[model samples]
Target: MSISPIAEPFYADARPIGPDGRRIGVLLSHGFTGCPASMVPWGRHLAGLGYAVAVPRLPGHGTSWQELNKCRWADWYGEIQRAFDKLTANCDQVVVGGLSMGGGLALRLAADRGRDVAGIVLVNPAVHTERKDVLALPVLQHVIPSLPGIANDIKKPGVEEHGYDRTPLKAARSMLAGWKQVRADLPKVTSPLLMFRSAEDHVVDPSSGQIILTSVSSRDLTERILEDSFHVATLDNDAPMIFEESAEFVRRVTGP
Candidate 1:
């Protein structure tokens, strides 16, 4: 008997930049259960600057919540590693960035790859939980699964006030496990990092940002607080700043 596929259909769309072929590729990873749709604009902006950009849809994303529930951190990290490898092959240098859980993955990649990665840009990375219920759980994660739900905290411009819109409990549990793993491995990240935090973020704990700054070994670390946005600062008032800062950081790291 033939076996069935384990993953859902997903895509990685690439956009090129510049005339001299001096492209600096950037790999963008989206938040948990979020598709590339959220990071498309950032990729486009980078592409406009003569850099190749790749945004990969993580495993179990852009599909039903059930698929997300079946995914683990390693699965998601594998997809990101593939995307990073592809970018490295196409460009002279590569930078990695992500939102929320994706940020955790980015940090993990930068840590593992060492100097191969040019830099990192993180927006509202979830390093620790302020949620008492989630932090209290021990073996309950393996016993019960949670459904995906709307994000209660978002400050994107002109977007409706909505939450994640789906709350896959099992997926969240797995992601939490991944976050813990990444947290343990933070000291390994040596690349220059730019961490952006939202002052009004209601979802992720504000201290998570500080933890990242203190944990990474990157001497060129820069931290910015977005006062007008929430957790999804990439699409909010701070987006332009993010775009500018990210481009600037990549330029600084890769040289003129």
Candidate 2:
């Protein structure tokens, strides 16, 4: 399958003189079945500020939904881990961010890597869902390959998220299962955290935000509610707010 131009991964190198004479890196990831296109604007905004930024296209994403069905949660996490390693190698400090499942992946990274992650910024991150249908996934995945997609949930008109039109069942099951482990290791995520959530998100319910805020051990935690957007707030009316506030968060956490 030919990759769409918008789906391509985005990268920006750290400048020699970054925040306080130290290079700062930001690793951003897209959600399940969603491509890097959703994060490119945010990545570019950070890069323009001289931050090394990497937004990786996860395995089975930016491609066909059938390919996504063949992948597991670990496969996506491996890609995020790889990008983090490379970004950290080139910068003195690193902060990780993600949207939806990508946020879950960032939490896993912070949990496993410890203080190496300077901070975390998440937007409508999903660690769990209140949808009862998920209980049928283990059996349904064997019976079906996919369901209708839950992408492009932005309230803004004409804003495309470039996510798969179908939600692969096998992959969905894997993501939900991985949430258990993330929840268990939440205490290991001790880095400063910032999260932005749309008050009217139709995709992720409030339970997800509640779980993260109550579970993570980060002492410096801030949660901001977005009133003018939906699930994909990164590209919606509140995007500028997310970008500017997040950039400020980066400076405060990575500053000497």
Candidate 3:
């Protein structure tokens, strides 16, 4: 598959001058149907601050929606796991962050990695949905191939997420199933967590945030509400705040 130039994966390795004199790494993932375009800017910002950063293009993403339909949750998670492994091998400390479904993937990594994940930052993470339509996905996926697009839910005038124009049902079903597993393992996530949620999100509902806040065992947890952004807060009006605050969070959590 020919990937779009803007949606290409991004990675940068930098030497660290932290208190412990150890390299710090940040691994970021984009949402379902969304490509690395949604995360490359944030990764570049962190890289500018002299941190090693990686934003990987998940399998079946950065291509067509029909290609995405052929993928399952494991395919995406495997790519994230590979990226995380690479980051950990090069850095003394690693932090994970994500947007939307990427957030769920981050949480799953935190849960599985335990203390290896120094911290986590989430923007409009989606783990559960209140939509009743999801209940019929199993039956609907066989009848139809997709639904309307859920990408680019940003309030910024000209910003584009560069995500799929259609939501593939088979892929959606796999993602929803993955969410259940992430939710079940939430108690295992003990790393510091900073979550940025949009006050008026059109994609993921508030229940996802609520579920995460109430379930995770992280002692250092913070949630910031983006009043002006939508589901894709990472590229919206409040993106600067997310970037700065997340950088601060990473510094504090990975410091000696």
Candidate 2 — worst ten consecutive residues by lDDT sum?
Answer: 13-22
Which tens-of-lDDT digit does each residue in 61-146 have in candidate 3?
A: 98899999999999999999999999999998999999999999999999999999999999999999999989999999999999
Candidate 1 ranges with C-alpha deviation above 4 Å: 1-21, 136-144, 147-152, 160-164
Supply every candidate's count of residue pairs whose N, Cα or C atoms clash at under 3 angstroms: 18, 0, 0
What would the per-residue lDDT of candidate 1 be over residues 19-100, giving only the tens digit for each residue? 5446678888888866676677777787777777888878777666667778888999999999888888877888899998
Models sorted by TM-score, best on top: 3, 2, 1
C-alpha RMSD for every candidate: 4.2, 1.0, 0.8
lDDT for each of the candidates? 0.77, 0.95, 0.95
| 73-135 per-residue lDDT for model 2 (tens digits) | 999999999999999888999999999999999999999999999999999999999999999
